[model samples]
Target: MDTSAPVRILTVCTGNICRSPVAERLLQAGLDQAVPGGFEVASAGTRAMVGEPMQPISADIVRTFGGSPDHFAARQLTPNILRGVDLVLTMTSGHRGEVLQLDASLLKRTFTIREFARMLDVLDQRAADGVAEAGAAVVPSTADAHDGASPLAANAAYWRGLPARAAGVRHLSLPADSSENDIVDPYRRDPGVYRQMEDQLAPAIVSILRHARLNAPSAEAAAGPGS
Candidate 1:
């Protein structure tokens, strides 16, 4: 259905061509498959090799997971890019800090990609445990309770509320080790390092896609749809 702008998501990393590009493309592909025009995912780097294509290994990784890495050009992160972004998923904790340094206002909305995925996974499990959100909107009695909100608008509202909800459940979902929250950087590293990156990153991406499909608004029950 026609609606206002799609929810805007930004993925950040050191070069934009590796981890962030994979996150951006896969997320865009997954969300598009679930609900076309429902979200816009982009990527940038704190120290970008601007205009560069996705690194070969990273591009292959994207292809390995059913996402295309075509026509992607790295961009340097800026305050302007952060403006109006509904969510920001960074590759590392340091990158998350850099994102905040550019726009402190994003403190609540930004998360390390793995961390965010874990939080979503926790929420997904809670839903499976019969503790589902009343309407999947942030608040049913307040600002998010628009009766005629378009599906896209409802989607934006739901996702925009997630960081807060995720924050509230942080204690219940903390990683066993802090390092688990950050994706490993394999730039210029050996195949083993790239493998480590894949091992670390792929699961988080899967969690995100699974959770997104679980939460996406359905034509019959936006509580979820799509494979």
Candidate 2:
């Protein structure tokens, strides 16, 4: 892609009616709040319940997180959908594998939601350290930087840069165990299971939005005068 186009992020799950839609809404809401219009979030299922709405409990959880669950119909995953998406976040390692089976080249941009969250934590620390090392060099003068690049645009560029960064550090062990990286499917389970899914998804959404905000042009402008 076109960097000028909105960064598209896709969330994948088995049926699309539960985990993926919930994650999709939550991420969109969070990103909207953090950096309005910075990204677009959509969801699909490897084996989709096509045209179905999200599970009632899943919608409730989304509402609890202040996300709207309206008009959400399940979609089937396809290589075409994957082709345009900037990032793919899956509910489980199995889902990630399914996505990769569709398009093997997506390996770099595809990650389990928890895995990406953990990676974001690492990236944030590295960014902080980079700023410190360069003696507050994180914020470049907006005038000297790319013309007409808004903070959201700058953040979008940073978002695009993640795959390369991830590739460079692929050899390093992740901080969490691989087993802990998956968000278990809560379909037809009790309310508590749905809550568990919410617990897992919410923070990861926050982390991603937070990182995007940090790279936004507004953030750079806010930091400019003081330095």
Q: Worst 10-residue stretch by lDDT in candidate 2?
A: 133-142
Each prediction's whole-model lDDT (CA): 0.83, 0.79
> Which lDDT tens digits does candidate 2 get at residues 1-227?
55545678999999999999988998899888766777899999999999999999999888988999999999999999898788999999999999999999988899999878876767677767763222223434222335556665555665676655644544452745777788978998988888788888888888877776665557455334534
Candidate that would win on TM-score: 1
**lDDT (tens digit, per residue) of candidate 1 on 117-176:** 888888888878977554454443112335555566666666777788877777878989
lDDT of 2: 0.79
Candidate 1: which pairs clash? 217-222, 218-222
Model 1: residue 214 alpha-carbon error in angstroms: 1.2
